[model samples]
Every structure is written in structure tokens, then in C-alpha cells.
Target chain A: DAGITQSPRHKVTETGTPVTLRCHQTENHRYMYWYRQDPGHGLRLIHYSYGVKDTDKGEVSDGYSVSRSKTEDFLLTLESATSSQTSVYFCAIRGLGEAFFGQGTRLTVV
Target chain B: QQPVQSPQAVILREGEDAVINCSSSKALYSVHWYRQKHGEAPVFLMILLKGGEQKGHEKISASFNEKKQQSSLYLTASQLSYSGTYFCGTEVQGNTPLVFGKGTRLSVIA
Candidate 1:
């Protein structure tokens, strides 16, 4: 893991409940991304923020939302958790070269 | 679109060599390689820009071919630490988020 941190390293939630995962970075990088990793799917981008208060949807943004109030924090929210959303979520900060990832948050929706 | 990775799984003996390939249907501006161990986050390996150049990361090296929209990761003298899932992420262009392949799981046995 790089300078990025994801809170709630592990969580078990119920379907239909709301959940939010937080990613904090000390790198002060301009690009922050939220991704979910599942078996056979590798990692799929959920959303990304280029700068503070600037966010955009990713390839698999449906059923997910993101907010970037500050350059150091990016939050991913699942309005209503679904079983399909259970996976390991990772946050990455892109530097001039490669993207550094957080330890990851494993969320289980039961 | 997500890139396609070949040989979804591989078994290699320590000190052996392995190659993982990633190909994209769309034009590629850059390619990023990352490795994720079981229960860990993905760590950056290397990045190759559109120049289709080859870059090295320790015993691992990568080559990108922009014209073919593909990238290959080469592991020389594989070590036990190299046993992990390798993912290739592609950026269609600058300022765009990456789309990852399904990943290639490498098992380096002693």
C-alpha cells in the first residue's frame, strides 16, 4: 500500500442498507480512483476524481456514487447495498507514472 | 472496454520464466502493470506510454505495442514473491481512467 488509506478494512452489511467507503491519501495527487475487485473480473473502476470537487463515473459506475470534497479524500457510496456489490474495494492515487493502491476494503453484503 | 489477458492462470517453478499478455480492442495510449498478492492490494509494477517502448522493473519487464494495442509482461527467474494475480490496465488516452483486464494468476512454486 502506498500513502493511501481505506477505512473499515472489513465490513459485513445487509442488503438494502447504505454503505460508504472512505479513501484518504497523503500523496496530494490530482487523480484518485475507486475500484472494486472480484473474482474473474480483476479490478473495475467505479469512479474517479481528477481534482477537488471534480468527479466522473467509470466503466462500472452504476449503483455507485462518489464524492471528492477535498484533494485528499474520495468517498464511494452505495445508496442501497446489493449482494452483487460485495467485493474487495481499492483506492488508487495516480502519480506521474503509476497508480499506488490502498490496502483494500472487503465488504460483504449478506 | 476492458483489455483481455491470456493464459488466465499459470504455474511456474522458481527461476523459471513466464509471460503474460494483455490486448485491447481500442487504441491504447498507455499501459500499466500491477501485481496483487492474495489478500493484499495491487502494487504498481510499471507503466508504458504510447511510444510502445520496453521498461524493466527489477526482474520483471514489460513491452507495449501501440499499433497493436497490446502489452506483455515478462518475468525472468521468477521468485516465490512473484506468485500473484497480474493485471494490465489500459488508458485510452491521457486524463482517462484505466480499464483493467481479467488478470493472470501466476503460481510460482519452489
Candidate 2:
């Protein structure tokens, strides 16, 4: 309940297609993160933003990109979708003492 | 670095007790606990900062040992609601994105 929401709750895109997921937060948090959750790989970080126009790659930042132009919005884009990229993506905002996640986006590449 | 979680999965009867441990190779500044039900986003449970802090959430509690770079979550008298995949996230420093463990699946039966 940290006022975070992920757009496109579910998406099915073809391989090689470009897909972008959006995360919007109303809490005005400085730290925002993107993570993908798979069966055995739990939550793997993809990208994160510390402030407007300031972002960093995460452990699993291959084939994916992120941009944050405003404090309330963070976007994750898959340049070319692949079957391996089919998973649930979560967006989180780090608050003073804890982090809160968005509902999540389920993307499937066919 | 991603933290390693012990007991990949666990099953328990209602009212039973269980503990999940998370260890990180890198030094940690904070440990965060979260639970995710199937097809849902993870919900924050608690966070323990540096200084070897211990915190509780109802019957669920966690202890963080900064010296060993490890954290343990304890669930006492588990209920059916406790059934979910538990993930422990570690941060090397304040305001940094968290790296999560593979997760510990817990199932509580009646």
C-alpha cells in the first residue's frame, strides 16, 4: 500500500517485439527498483533508479533497459522479447524503513 | 550479490513453528523479509537494519546479524495464511536496491 502501481497487469507479446512496462508511484520515493520473479530464481533485479535521470543496471540487466525521467515514474523495456523473458515483473519503492512492491506485471513471450 | 536461503521448501501443520535462514556473501547493511502468494506480488514483512537488530510482526519475527551477514525469520504457531514463498533481500548499504534470495516456499496445512 505504498501507492505503487504497475501498468499492463498482463501482456502477451511475440518474440522480437518491443515491450515496455511502467511503474508509477505516488509516494515520491527516491529509490525505485525492477525485479523479475521466476520459479527457481525468486526475484532478480533488472534495473533501479535512485533519482530522476539516475539509473543503474542490476544483476539481470541483459536485454532489458530502464529509464526514469520523473520521481514518480520508472519504466522497464524489453528491447526484443524472448521466451526466456516470460515472467512476472515487480516494481518496488524503498521507503524510510521498508520497501513496498507493486501488484506485478505478468509478461509472456510467444 | 544474491543471498542464499536454506530449506528451499517447508510444509507444516497448523500451529507448528518454522524458521527460514538467509545468508549473504557480501557484507549487509539491512535485511528485508517478504512473502508472496502464488500469482501475487510480494508483501513486505519487516526490515532489520544494521547493528544486529531484531523485529517482530505479529507471530512472525526476524533477526539480523550484521557480523555474519545473515538473517533468520521465525514463524511461530503458523497459520494457513502463512503459506507463501518467503524471500529475504539484502542491501549492502542504505538506499541501495536489494538483492533477494531464491526464496523459501512454506505451506501450512490444516
Candidate 3:
């Protein structure tokens, strides 16, 4: 129900190709996060941004990069797609006490 | 680190009760609960801060134990709508991103 949106809700890319997923929010939240969900792995943090141009790596930041040039937009990019990187990616923005998530983007790399 | 959730999966009849527990090895600043259907974004359920508080939403309730670095979620008189995967996320401090547990899949049968 939050004002969060993810672009390219579903995507399929060939291996070694670069892919980027976009997360946009209208809540003006200061904290934005990118997470990936696999079948057995509930959710793993990929990267997060606290403010414009301020970003940090998470537990599974390998092969991924993030940029937050504006407060409402956060981008997650896979330098080179791989089958192992196929997963559902979610974007979340921290609100009063809880975080609001987007509809999620399902990406497939073959 | 990710929290450890008990009972990887659960099955309950309509109007029955069930409980899901989440434990962490590191200290917790807060515990967050979320639920996701088969293929959708996770929906925020509740958040328990460091004060070791208990909160409820409808028939769903959760308790946080700061001392034990754990949290528990209780679903009373469960309904079919409750059939989903429940995840517990732990935050080490304010403004910090969460580390989520391997979710518990709940199936409610009529």
C-alpha cells in the first residue's frame, strides 16, 4: 500500500548481459533498501542507501551495485547477469516504524 | 546475520491457532514481521522495538524479548487468508537495514 513502485516487473536476460532494476517511491523516506528472495532463502539484503549518494553494501552485495542520486529513486544493477543471480528483487523504504515494499521485480538470467 | 526461525512450515485448520518463533545470535534493536503470498511483495505486519513490547493486529500478535534476542508471532483462530510465508527481520539499530530469517510457510486448510 505504500507509494513504492518497481520498474520492469518481470524481465529475462541472457547471461553476461547487464541488467538494472529501478525502485521509485513517493514517500520521501530517507532509507531505501534492495533485497533478493530465492526459493529457500527468505530474503537477503543486496544494498541500501540512507541518503543521496550515500550507499552501503549488504551481506550479498557481490555482482550487484546500487545508486541513490535522488531521495525517491533507488537503482540496483547487475554488472553481468548469471543464473545464480536470478531472483525476485524487492525495494523497500523505511517509514515511521516499519518498511514499505514494492511489488517486486522477478528477473531471470539464462 | 539472519535470524533462525522455527518450524520451517506449519499446517493448521481454520479457526486453529499457531505460533512462529524467531531467534537471533546477535543483539537485536527491533524485530519486524512480514508475510508474503506465493509470488508477491512482502506485506509489513508489525514491529517490536527494543523495549520488549507486544503488539497485535487483528488476530495476529507478536512479542519481542530483548533479553533473549528473540521474537514470537501468534496467530489465533487462523483463517485461509493466513496461508502465506511469514518472515522475521532483525535490525541492529535505528536506520539500519534488516536481516531476515528463512520464512515459515503456513498453510490453513478448511
Over the stretch A29-85, how does candidate 2's per-residue lDDT look in tens digits? 999999998889999999999899999999999999999999999999999999999
Question: How high is each candidate's TM-score?
Answer: 0.97, 0.98, 0.98
Please tell me which model should have the higher TM-score, number 1 or number 2. 2
TM-score for candidate 1: 0.97
lDDT of 1 by residue, A1-110 (tens): 46889998999999999999999999889999999999989899999999999999988998999999999999999999999999999999986768889999999999
DockQ order of candidates, top first: 2, 3, 1
Residue A62, model 2, lDDT: 99
Chain A TM-score for predicted structure 1: 0.97
The C-alpha stretches of model 2 lying farther than 4 A from their native spots are none
Question: Compared with the true structure, what per-residue lDDT tens digits does model 3 show for residues B1-110?
Answer: 88999899999999999999999999889999999998888999999998889999999999999999989999999999999999999999877999999999999999
Interface RMSDs of the predictions, in order, are 0.8, 0.7, 0.9
**lDDT (Cα, tens digit) per residue for candidate 1, span B65-109:** 989998999999999999999999999888689899999999999
Candidates' lDDT values, in order? 0.93, 0.94, 0.95
Please give fnat for model 2: 0.94
Stretches of candidate 1 above 4 Å error? none
Q: What ranking of all candidate models by TM-score puts the best one first?
A: 3, 2, 1
Instruction: Please give, for residues A8-98, the per-residue lDDT of candidate 3 as tens digits.
Output: 9999999999999999999999999999999889899999998999999999999999999999999999999999998999999996589
Clashing pairs for predicted structure model 1, backbone only: none
Name the lDDT value of residue B75 in candidate 2: 100
